[model samples]
Target chain A: MSSSDLLLGLSQKALQLLQEDADKIEKLIEVQMENLTTRQCPLYEEVLDTQMYGLSREIDFAIRAELIQESAGKQIMVKLERNLAQLYEALSQSKE
Target chain B: MSSSDLLLGLSQKALQLLQEDADKIEKLIEVQMENLTTRQCPLYEEVLDTQMYGLSREIDFAIRAELIQESAGKQIMVKLERNLAQLYEALSQSKE
Candidate 1:
């Protein structure tokens, strides 16, 4: 299987395990982000590795898991790009 | 440092290690992907784990590494989504 298929399979499997509530999944992501910011993720290195392999996979998963239309992913991408810039600005400001 | 910063830093560092040719980075990704399908990535599982933690990082890396613009990320993401679907269809055709 291609990595994407493997990932999509895993995504389908994981979501099967989840309750299929878009709100819950979004909340889950939010909570995950909160956890990342609040705690030290020692496993960050490992996770980042998988990310290199399947960055597109999780993105595709989020699209389906959240029932986001194709256009929505674009908006999300734009928002995330802006958010990262804002975050960097905030961090840079704090550092100065 | 935040995870994004860590990634961006590593990305900057890796590119520094590379020769700063966007084509080289894209070729590297293509080669890595071809290797993935041709060989068994025993490390795939670990990488996948990290991916859940930082999918956005690699995407950003590719963007900067390739010198793709803000809107280009969106277009790339869309093409990727389509490519994945095509890959899946091809795989299923092979299996049947």
Candidate 2:
């Protein structure tokens, strides 16, 4: 495969990992949300609503962009996974 | 509230953001996975399964830990959001 193809493949694979973690997290959130007292949700709602807005954008810069973007994407996913694992642990502990 | 309470609140808020992004991404992934050719899943399954293992642990170091952990968690959530935004854009482009 060509370089773009390689980057595309890696990007897709990394995205799949992200999606997987997201799925597990959603279920966790649902359980936590349900158990949270009504009073607590109101306290959190302000912060949560602001952050829950959305996600997406694009760019067309010219210098070695595809590979750079692909590499950065992979690193972000790795960091995301590590942080997520930590967060999951902390949240679980909080629940107990 | 005290500093520890502040840290705990911030950590919980950040976790909520992470959970929100994960939910959106999971839906995106499900759509992509459904559309993916059957042959492709086998190739990607190994990477996906290994990464899917799990998430968590703890540390008991002595210096300014709660604040540090909370700050680190916030930063990770910020980075995670930015990266997720980028990944969402890239994946959407791929689909198109």
Candidate 3:
């Protein structure tokens, strides 16, 4: 399958699992973000940014598809923004 | 960037974010897997498998690249297998 399709599938799966509890999903996302911040490579960082962005987009799709609750989606978004801010911090730190 | 590159980049980032805590990483993976299991489409299920397989390969690459601890890598593999089994089960259920 195409990468986009693959991502969509995984995103759908993830929503199925986590759609019931935004807090739990947010925590899991935090774990992912923590893993992302350890890399020093710019390319790697770009990849992280891209993946999170893509996942977020998929979450949006889930909402549009009516596959997930709006509250859950919003929780995910908040978590994503938090991780993104941390990612920015991590990226800036590596510049030193 | 190419899809492979994007996946690679994100994998590295995920390792960076999560290399320290195998349990935590596994939990996040479980969350992702749970999200993946909700889709009933064969194409979508294939996508989930592909994504996980790709991520596992990336983990192997990281091990070779000396980006993450070997023990952590093993943990990821275990978690991957567990999720894969669940994915299989989910796929089978949908086929019924």
Per lDDT, what order, best first?
3, 1, 2
> Please, what are the lDDT tens digits per residue for candidate 3 over residues B1-93?
555665555456556544433444456446645665464444654555445544554454345434456787778778667766776776567
- Judge candidate 3 against the unseen true structure and give its global Cα lDDT, from 0 to 1: 0.55
lDDT of every predicted structure (CA atoms): 0.41, 0.38, 0.55
The candidate scoring highest on TM-score is 3
Worst 10 residues of 3 chain B by lDDT: B17-26
Better of 1 and 2 by lDDT: 1
Write model 2 residue lDDT over B1-96, tens digit each, in one string: 554464455445435543443455445445445555432344343332221211011111101122125455445445444654554565556557
Distance from true location, Cα of A4 in model 2, Å: 50
Docking class of 2: incorrect
Instruction: Candidate 3: list runs displaced more than 4 Å.
Output: A1-96, B1-14, B17-39
Q: Report model 2's chain A TM-score.
A: 0.37
Recovered share of real interface contacts in candidate 3? 0.03
| lDDT string, candidate 3, A43-90, tens digits | 654555445544554455345434456787777677767766776686
lDDT of 1 by residue, A31-75 (tens): 445554455355643443343234334344435333224564455
DockQ of each: 0.03, 0.02, 0.03
Candidate 1 lDDT for residue B92: 49
DockQ, Cα level, model 3? 0.03
Can you list the residue pairs that collide in candidate 3? Answer: A13-B35, A13-B36, A14-B35, A14-B36, A34-B17, A35-B16, A35-B17, A35-B18, A36-B17
